[model samples]
Target chain A: MRSKASPVSDRSKGQAGWGLKSAAWFGVLYLNLPILFIILYGFTTDDASYSFPPPGLTTQWFAVTWARADFWEALWLSVQVAFASMLIAMVLGTFAAAAMYRFKFFGKEAVTLLILLPIALPGIVTGISLRSAFSLGDVPFSYFTIVLGHATFCIVVVYNNAIARLRRSSPALIEASMDLGADTFQTFRHVILPNLATALLAGGMLAFALSFDEIIVTTFTAGQQETLPIWMFGELSRPRQRPVTNVAAIFVMIITFVPILAAYYLTRDTDDVAGSGK
Target chain B: MTTTGAARPRSLSNSFSTFLYQRPRLVLALLLVPPLLWLGIIYLGSLFTLLAQSFFSIDDFTAQTIYEPTLATYARLFTATNLSIIFRTLAMASVVTVISGIIAFPLAYYIARFASGRMKALFYVAVMLPLWSNYLVRVYAWKLILAKEGAIHWSINSLGLGPVLDWILTLPVVEGSSLSTSYIGTTLTFVYIWLPFMVLPIQAALERVPRSLLEASSDLGARPNETFRKVIFPLAIPGIAAGSIFTFSLTLGDYIIPQLIGSSRPFIGQAVYQFQGTAGDIPMAAAFAMVPIVIMAIYLAIAKRLGAFDAL
Candidate 1:
């Protein structure tokens, strides 16, 4: 009987048997193959077309990408937009989360549904809606318009993280601080902020990454301004400079990957803290 | 509290904090108003404006939007050509969602159950890395890989499976000179891009299943497959529902993949782009944009009843 129970525990580990393991690995391979292929093709020497095995290999495309002024300008614009959107989203999302956590209100669920709408609905709807609104209001499309579009969705991400963290942190801690002679500002600064620090960090990094790689909404909102993804979209139509584009693709992979990795690490252990036992 | 300092005047910041603390309603209002205004006015207001524009008609002579509320644009939307674009996008989105859900389940199950500690973390990062990476680059990489003179072709030729590959391309629905020039390529790319969205939600759902229940089922003389059929799958449905929403809506609204990799027939997204841009028809474009909004609204309503948003 003891042996039977041991086999049951070992054999049906979480009820995911051996067959599913290989299937999962296959799925992982499918997810990553194109990304790996992009890195591989980035080193190809042939500038004109892509083939399975390259005819030659060279480091020249790096130099060409380095020398291109347009690439730098596009990269800088994306950085600025991402930074501005992240800042705005962090502030607004945290405030909204705090309010929701502290009080019961009429129509709160509807507000949540509305907050989720920008990301929940299709991007084309959001894009065209904003574009039409801008035209109707006689607002010229500029860098600010792009940030507005990106921040609409970015706020959702930060709000989800902040609200989740706020819910997990015991409300009693805030009350305790006030009882100990700390004023509202001091309670928030000393007790709430430290508890929220990691979740906000994770949320902000994710928002930044999403904003940095955003293209569809940016397409409608960015009148004359070019972000890196928009630049890549244009470059796609021209096939002669394929390797340089691949180099730029690799650059994008690195820029977005670092922040995402940092975010994963920052929030991975948070489940154990902030009154999570409930 | 500076006990050493004799009767000092309170600073403005302290007094303000005290006032705010005393008035909870004011604090709540302060925290809530800015975001509410941004979302309520700027976001939903724009959506309403787009919906309103769809009801108007365009003037042919001057190429301006007529302010008179009419259904002329929607009447045009019911034309056979326009209807084809809408149906084509619907079919593509449905197929992509089903395929992504199927492909994501086992992987999600494995990650949720089999992997642990560092291995679990590694699987998570593996699933998320491509999702967080550049969207256009992944699409472009697929373009290169599926081209006539590309990796798939080379690999098939090397494996002596060239004839098989050629035969698949000759099928009526997927017919093309190469994979890159077919709707098949566009479908494949959509599934690839949205697969992670499906995986994460399903994994989260599967993780929430209690291990003791499985043990109890096994102890009751039930076979593993029987236990799974009766218990595991029903639990994962909400996650699959949540994930399908993403894959379906994204495919419905995407213009770039079909434009870059597939047949020339315009999907709903491309038609919207064209009507708004070169065709100089805002009413028509807004009308086209309403297709996805209406479909997703219905879809989300069904999913919400199934508790899909909770998984999200």
Candidate 2:
């Protein structure tokens, strides 16, 4: 029985190794294929509708996308929303992080949980709740409400980054500054702010990217205002402007790719920062 | 400890220093106030109002009238059809979570264990690139692939196995034959969309497993399988839980994927969309929204019990 079990275990180990490799390759291809297709189709001049392998290749759609005013309007709206959301998220998240990190206050855990709750809950719930809240309060659904909704979730991203950074920073630095006769504002400016700079920037970048691509919450909050995602949604449902939808998607890809890549790098070094806390 | 004239000024400064050390509290409050108020007023406030709206009956199918309180919407939600919708949504979410977890584990393992600096960065970028793309565009891209004359069918036809394909295609359960707009498509899309969320957290958790632990296990004559099962898996469970919460909750609340791919069948998300958008029954929509919230609350409670919330 022992001999039989040993051989079976050996055989299973070999199978597991091969299985892991195959799965890894398959997973990589699955993720990359749609992105590759999107990039490839951007150059295709399929006027009627999009096909996987276009019969002809041309940059005409790119020209058409460039010349379109609606595209610009949607892109502008997206930028406005993203920027507004990021600003609000950074300020609120920074303060929240600072409060949670520095102070021993009542309801500190509850406050942190509340802040994180919006993110942990599905976007749909957030959207629905916001929609209901706006209607209940008789608040008009507009750009401001959209900004508010996006910022709710975006704050979580910023807070995660900020709090992580704050935890990593040594308390001795602040104590040293105080002993050296620096004021709170001076210490913040010279020490705390500089230490938090990379985290804040990374958080802001991630917030911007998230807000830029956000559709679910925007759908609930933006009554008439059309962000790029909303515009793309409308375009896709109505088949007349299918290629335009592809064009808008390509634009989204370009806008989001750089910042998201940077965020990944920023977060990849998470262990180093986390270790610093100890 | 001196309280004389010279010591008085030093004490005053000491008090000032203490005040300065804790000034972040006031700053935090000031910073947190606007966003917190925004959430309180716009998010939680709306949720309460929505719940209230659900109790009030719609009068004459026009402006919702608060004439009488009833549980009609809740009753409607419990109907066999709506129950099926709820079940389907939950089932799809479960499947997506499990499948994405399975697919993500190895990739995450590879990144965390085998890959180093540049390769890690490249792989990380590859994983997240899809997330940055327009959600609608990604759905539409799938539409192009899944359509009748799309890539899948084209590839099959081009291989000169057209007859064999046709025979398989003629099968009742084949996607083109009345099954295209089924749970399969919706589940596939959910898996694709939420895979990254699962990957990142699991990878992060796997990376946290101490190298010394693995070395110690191997030194003790434990094989790779034993090391992973005994040491790595336990540490990574919290991440797996976080990833599951993300994938499951997101898929549950998503109306767009099912609307785009799933046939005329209504998932909870689409039911809410219809209740609010098409049917104009805001109260019913709000009630439907609670389905996912309840599920998530339960999930969070469980996750908290498992210490997953700390990792977040």
DockQ metric for all predictions: 0.62, 0.40
Best by DockQ: 1
Interface RMSD of 1: 2.2
Candidate lDDT values, in order: 0.89, 0.77
Task: Write down the DockQ of candidate 2.
Answer: 0.40
Query: Which residue ranges in model 1 land beyond 4 Å of their true spot?
Result: A1-16, A274-276, B1-15
Question: Could you give candidate 1's per-residue lDDT for residues A22-106 as a string of tens digits?
Answer: 8898899999988878888888987788887888788889999999999999999999999999999999999889988889989
Q: What is the C-alpha RMSD of each candidate to the true structure, in Å?
A: 3.1, 5.8
Interface RMSD of each: 2.2, 4.1
Q: Model 2 chain B, TM?
A: 0.86
